[model samples]
Target: GAGVSQTPSNKVTEKGKYVELRCDPISGHTALYWYRQSLGQGPEFLIYFQGTGAADDSGLPNDRFFAVRPEGSVSTLKIQRTERGDSAVYLCASSLIGHRGELFFGEGSRLTVL
Candidate 1:
């Protein structure tokens, strides 16, 4: 079984740009979550999807951030009008529901806004 993986482990972009971070979750897992972690801080929940629908997205900072899990598996985080404050590690995790699960995190997509 494959663990979650993220692309562009590092990304640098200017202010007011757009960026998309991809995440590949573990096979057969139906629960996917996205979290943003700043330096020396715990991961802040961004969005969580159970199956093909987003169960919780209140953690998304603003409209600039959005995510989707069309096939109930892989997901992507899209950020528009990127700002320096958006610089952080975007982590993706997946787990088995109701199984006393622990989220398995990806290396993370580190975004740098300059």
Candidate 2:
């Protein structure tokens, strides 16, 4: 029963570069979600996937952000043309299903755009 995990717990990047963050969800969990949390703020939903298709991606900020969950397991968030405003903690969570279930979050990938 591996819990969700994220890599590069901290990342520092330039304002216009691209970066990719990885997440590994728990086994047997079919619902995966990505969220962003700025300092002193609650997590804001970014995207979610059920199986291989993105069930909800309404929270993605703009075209600069995108994510994919292939094989219904591991997921990755990709950011293009990063900006200082994009600096935040990107969190990944997963649950058995999308509903009122509780979401287990990873330590998060902290992105700092300079």
Candidate 3:
């Protein structure tokens, strides 16, 4: 019954800390996604999952970022050695199908790196 959900509504960290962002998608939805939004920009596609596997992960900027959807219902985004440039609103979304269905999006986790 729940829509997409994300944890740690806000986080502030030093530049070198590691962070893990979590998302819980709507039950039975097979498409889950992670996106990032910086300041005034629209959310940028980071990665997407169809069922239990990552279908697209090309949007990740570099090796510091990774995501997983092991059971097709929940996913996590991991960032290593975070930088001030990494500060942004990390959003999660889900749909019934891959990239074509109505997307249900989460409120997003705001990360601030100092």
Q: Report the backbone clash tally of model 1.
A: 0
For candidate 1, which ten residues in a row score worst on lDDT? 95-104
Per-candidate TM-score against the hidden true structure: 0.95, 0.97, 0.96
Highest lDDT, which number? 2
The TM-score ranking, best first, is 2, 3, 1
Weakest lDDT window of 10 consecutive positions for candidate 3: 1-10
Regions more than 4 Å wrong, model 1:
98-100
Judging by lDDT, tell me the better candidate of 1 and 2: 2
Q: What is the lDDT of residue 7 in candidate 2?
A: 95
Query: Considering lDDT, where higher is better, how would the candidates rank from best to worst?
Result: 2, 3, 1
How high is the lDDT of residue 29 in model 3? 91
Residue-level error in angstroms, candidate 2, position 27: 0.7
lDDT value, candidate 3, whole model: 0.92
Candidate 2: stretches off by over 4 Å: none
